[model samples]
Target: MSFRDEVEDGRGDLRKPFLHTGSWYRMGSRQSSIMGSSQVIRDSSISVLACVLIVALGPIQFGFTSGYSSPTQSALSKDLDLTVSQFSLFGSLSNVGAMVGAIASGQIAEYIGRKGSLMIAAIPNIIGWLAISFARDFSFLYMGRLLEGFGVGIISYTVPVYIAEIAPQNLRGGLGSANQLSVTIGIMLAYLLGLFCSWRVLAVLGILPCLILIPGLFFIPESPRWLAKMGMMDDFEASLQVLRGFDTDITLEVNEIKRSVASTSRRTTIRFADLKVRRYWLPLMIGIGLLVLQQLAGTNGVIFYSTTIFESAGISSSNAATVGVGAIQVFATAVSTWLVDRTGRRILLIVSSFGMALSLLVVAIAFFLKGFVAEDSSLYGIFGILSVVGVVCMIVSFSLGMGPIPWLIMSEILPPKIKGLAGSVATLANWFSSWLITMTAPLLLAWSSGGTFSLYTVVCIFTVAFVAIWVPETKGKTLEEIQHSFR
Candidate 1:
């Protein structure tokens, strides 16, 4: 079904997801009252812990589903008696399903709060894992995989937004970075576990995160920003109070959120036509641009064909190389989580994009050298090692910034009203680019591995320039402050 159909709320009405326009923060209009800083520090630490724990599950599930098929590929093919072409389709179907989910996610999050959207996503994931575990036919397997993909697509948009909204300004970037860390961790878990478990058991493991999240949702507060936007004043205040701590003197914050919400109340339904305004379109471009460049930088090209890349690098154990890649991703993302708050988003992105570019250039050079050297020569061996180093560098460089920052910035920059629409568009563009890059990667590799990476190198270089020129430092600003900074 189309997203229009999916967006129909339980009340049988299509709730238009609104985009907030103009500078609504209007700080002068709000009153300020200071709460005891020490009291707030003491209480809010525990307050948001549950929220982080729960929301992080979505990313873990994303990683798990992504890493699941890697080790299970042969078993899936053998058991289903699938041809290479059919197996390739099975592997990529998640992207197709993800595109659908990405399109529908904004509206889903709009109708339901961020928490509710996550809860909705969890159902599909749980059911998908169960179906995958129990499947006796290809149809069940396909449906299960698609459902898991759809769930993650929804999770992809919702988790970062949720974290950004609820997190204190000082901690937003670091917390947002956690989402990517969870993704890497989930991927590592799947890869490590897939070695010991059967495909069915691994599928069952995929269900566990959602199982934890389903119950955990109840214990956390919804996004106060979303609550206020819906004009649910009581719940809004309650959620914010809970997030900040009960006695954290939320008067100033409450007034700020109320004013933003009050301004948004008038523009409750965003039509496709409404995006014509420069305000809406500008952020859309930024969000979509980052996502596209993130893909065009060819992170997926490396990921989908890491084994081939390792072999081409003259690595004897392709599996070990792939495992090393996953390990680096997890480590780099952990470092990103620490660095994001300190360095801010823009610098990290510029650095990441540039680093990846240089890394890709090295790989291109190594491959170019490989073409010239005899396979038995010591020079070829050196080039082979260089290729492996370049591959690791590329993955590390990507994990540091490009992997997490685009979604973080997208969540931070878009006003709540337009977040659903713009986020959906950006995410859809991401999935489409992923599909395009994945589809053409083998041909590109065949035509020239050096040339393929050179193309990505150019894109990565452009990404650095883009970040330097266009992306803002969203390090410690309130959501309202960050959105208005774009103005």
Candidate 2:
């Protein structure tokens, strides 16, 4: 029988008829209706609250490291006697590690299961934090940061997939946004801790969340969808029972799983070969384009060099400048979470890019004007105020656009069969672009601050064009629905 006919007839295991070949498949139409009713009941069992708690644990670590690293850069540079080049190398090295981790973790998640991978990812993350807190040398600090990046990369790629797989179709967007929200909260917490306490103390404190998360692993069930793929039908049903909360139509779930596995089995594992095809090329380009745009908008440049930006604006005190930048990032990201779902991804990208382009223009103008100013106090004051406004506008624009959308889109787009691989590629692109941006910003600043902002303005314009051409509206689609879009 055809796939559609089987589906309509309630013969859910159409692809793998043997899996349900026993008495289970012989049940009458009444039995099918009862099973369908049970699935509806089972669907009601999945708790949004539990899923939120599990997903939030991973992003907290991401936010803590991303936000806290900026404030510590000055201290690290001074303590390690880093020249400008060496300091830039530090940022590049972390992204290198993240790129490696993102690629490796996809295969790792397939083998170990998402929860297992999450548990393992946290161990290195906790250790990395502890190492940074006590590091006495540049190499030690670099190693610690590298490990932390690896952990972040793994969690970043995995947690969204896990949450998306487990969440009810209706709630996935909010839960997905929760991951972003937790990251913001973590950023805010790290910023607050860095402001009030020692960097070492804040680094050590960052590891505490892992302690809470490690225990959660035991309670949360594996993705029922994953179990179905393994041909462990019994375990798959059991997982669905626990996750969904009632007995489900195992046949329907199994059929969906069979279709997924059948489709995936036809292709080789993630490789360069996968990108050689016309069908895959567009998605790959879109993924990489988003990554490049995200970095070119100067989000990481701002994040890593926020202190320097603030100081250049005439905040002479180093500590206060770092704290101020951190505060701005925290508040901006918090606002992003609220606006992301409501504004839709495309509109936010367009509006924010416009804002960023305008902000960069202002900065370039301010710097150019500063060069012509005589040693007049009023001129200096005016230049400083303009510079501060420029930086604030840039931060707000970035938080709204580049900061959240890449992650959100990466998690949502692409077929499930290639999600792990596609996500890795996108994430790798993100980290590598971030590395280049961070590594070059200091040199760019020193060479020609006005020229640096001008370059970013140009890139932001390209970002606007790319979004208009390639990005699809994924604002309210289910995972199954999203996969169908690519098909």
Candidate 3:
């Protein structure tokens, strides 16, 4: 009569089914009765807040790296006596570090708990920030950037997994949005700090969250799913008790865990060869393709080089232009917090791609006509407006699809056994694509600004086409349900 019994009885369609568990329902019950009906809501609420705070900390590091580097790239270039090519190398190398870190962190997380993995990630972040604050030469600065990139990669891969594992099925989308929200807020904070103070001061401030939050992490509980995977049944039940918040049948929960774990354990060890199977390969392709599409839309190019883009478009104050672009990014992501669950992934991606293509086309036209408008104030005004539109479009587009969903989808798509490896591969793809785009932006700018924007516009068109054909609808699907789709 329990939920697990019903599943075993084949009483309902397993395909596209939503299991009511955790704090939401009791087993053998047709109605969605609250588990431990009195206190379940209270405990789940507290647990979610804790997860949000911890996950949000990881994103501040990402925001610091993504936002701080751009406005100060020119300053660092001047101070370090470096050429444009060196700056590009700096960006690419950071991505290289990120690529390594993401892969390593997955195994670490699997060995330790998600909370412990995140705490470990925070160490390099704090060190990176401290090093950047006092970096005296290009080499030291490059080292700091690499360290920061490594920390970001770890945090990015681990935090979403933690959130997904801990969050209740009904609230997953909203909680997942917190991760993106934090990143946007972090970016906004970094830009504001960079605007008002020296880059060193901004870098120094970046270390504060790591210092303040490290102690708080100890009080948090390990993920129930992770505990189950480790065969820590007592700890898993205890963790679930805290998470679920009510007196409920532990039997159903334990059985569900056993079913999932059994399924995973029967699978072969994840070799690169595992990805050759269609069941594994399809999700991996989706993950990598999403990252590639994100970069090809030139989101990072516009964000990291917004000042240069604005200057080329005739903006006078590079600092002011970059700040404006940063503000647009924050606002657009904030809007996405509301839009993502409501609008669904595919719609947002399609809309964003078209919007980006249109904005880039306008920017390309402005760049192509630069000679004719050299002295025209009206043309400058028009160009500035279009640049702002482009930035807004990029932010909105990215937040809705590329910014948050890639990680969210990747976390859910793979089976638990391969989750760590698959997540690492997907994240590596993300960093590599980021490196490719960031490293190429400056060269592309120097070669032909109009041509670069046009190229991105073309890429966006192809991305839209691909999304329509290949990406499955993951909206409202449970982690297990998502994986089942591929099979």
lDDT of the candidates, in the order given: 0.82, 0.70, 0.72
Off by over 4 Å in 1: 1-42, 266-268
- Model 2, span 7-48: residue lDDT tens: 579864423311121123223212636646334334433454
What tens digits encode model 3's per-residue C-alpha lDDT throughout 1-487? 5434555798632211111122322221223254544343345756666657866788877876778776567677787787877777776666777888988877767766687778888888888878878988778778887888888889888888888777766667667767877877787787777767777788888898788667767655677777666555555665666566554455665676667766664222356766677678788888778876777778888888777777776668877767766676667766766676677777777777777788788778777776466556787678666766665666666676667766776676766877777778888888888888888888898899888989999998898898888878767766666766777
Task: Give the 10-residue window scoring lowest on summed lDDT in candidate 3.
Answer: 13-22
Q: What is the lDDT of residue 228 in candidate 2?
A: 55
Q: Candidate order by lDDT, highest to lowest? A: 1, 3, 2
What are the runs in model 3 whose C-alpha is more than 4 Å off?
A: 1-43, 74-87, 247-254, 266-269, 371-374
- Residue pairs whose backbone atoms clash in candidate 1: 18-417, 19-417, 19-418, 20-417
| CA-only RMSD, every prediction | 6.7, 6.9, 7.2
| lDDT score at residue 1, model 3, on the 0-100 scale | 53
The collision pairs in model 2 are none
